[model samples]
Target: APAPTPTSTPTSTPTPPSHAGRVLLPHPDFRLFLAIDPRHGEVSRAMRNRGVEIFLLPPSLHDPDLISSSSPSSLSSSASSVGNGTATTATTATTTTTPNTPNTSTPPPPFHEEVRLLASQGLFGSSRRLRAAVVAAHARLAAACVRVHKRPPDLRELAHFAQLASTLACRGWPALAALVVAWRQIYLRSLGLGGADMVVGLRVLAQMVREAGVGSTLGVAG
Candidate 1:
């Protein structure tokens, strides 16, 4: 009992601090407009997987309102004219005169021209919008690849932007996406994305091109 060793009380080890899991919200400054339909489910999933929030724009967004509001007097006159069969007479007159009028509806610019115009207008200024467009273009390319078994004609200009954006997005860097696009526009060459990133980006572009059978038309081969 002399030195009956004071029974040493075992001290409890301190528990390690617990860290709550972080919930990654979508980037706050960007908004993407996508149609809400089953057809776009794959693209929607891809955007979300990249931490982008999808905003479902109604199909109406694509349809501009062609009907202009009319005054009551105008409406009444229109109805009365229809009742008097004047509308039919007018249609007949238009049909008789139609052949003389030249076809004035201009075709839309080619897809590449559209892309160039959009880029020039600073439409791809934000990472979010750029990313959304890229996703769309990528979907188009994939579909073309499957259906035509080659790079579709429309995939050349559009798909290249998609490839650049996708490459940066995959690297977890959205900010760099716009930079790359700007570089391509101004310099007409791929941005020097360091050794590894450059290699990865080129590989991704090559794969996309190969799958779509776009070859040198994508403008990414250089």
Candidate 2:
């Protein structure tokens, strides 16, 4: 057999580990936890130019319950009815269609009463941070009310402010009492309300603050 031809087995090449699967890697323009308050639009832009990727921590990440009450159907219904009354009648060539609206046609309850009812129901969620924020905001509102009215805030007023703070916290924003105070001040100023007249303005101010704080947070820019 002529030296039985030397048999050689081919060696298989080892595949290198993929960078795509690696958990950690070095890269420019890394994610930076800059507390950039969205209200400060100018500062935010400046930071973005410095190779810092601003990562906004969404409320849902921390508190899934933030949008738990906001079901698609509920949102759609709320959207369709906002500022247009409960039912909007559409006139067509052949027929008029009036979508079946919820019983919201009834005038909303008085603002203070509504707040009291919400508070009684324990509308606040179960987050320690949220609770603390709400308590601080409530204290601030109470103090402001005392300073303005020369008297302690009524139970309804306190409840209303507490409800506001809790709502803001639940939505994952710092329940800033200063913001609420500013909102009330501005509304009162615009209405030229003084003393007792300011009490009535709370309803409008609450609505304004709630609308403004939607999908908003507080933090230092840059």
The number of clashing residue pairs in model 1 is 1
| Candidate 2 collision pairs | none
lDDT of 2 by residue, 90-149 (tens): 221122324431121112212333222322424333332222223333333444444455
- Residue 180, model 2: Cα distance from true site in angstroms: 5.3
Work out the TM-score per prediction.
0.20, 0.23
- Give me candidate 1's TM-score against the actual structure: 0.20
Tens digits of per-residue lDDT, candidate 1, 133-172, equal 3333333333333343433324354545544544444345
**What is the C-alpha local distance difference test score of each model?**
0.34, 0.39
Q: What C-alpha lDDT does candidate 1 achieve relative to the native structure? A: 0.34
Which stretches of candidate 2 lie above 4 Å from their native place?
A: 1-45, 59-64, 69-180, 186-200, 205-222
Output the lDDT of residue 53, model 2.
67
TM-score of 2: 0.23
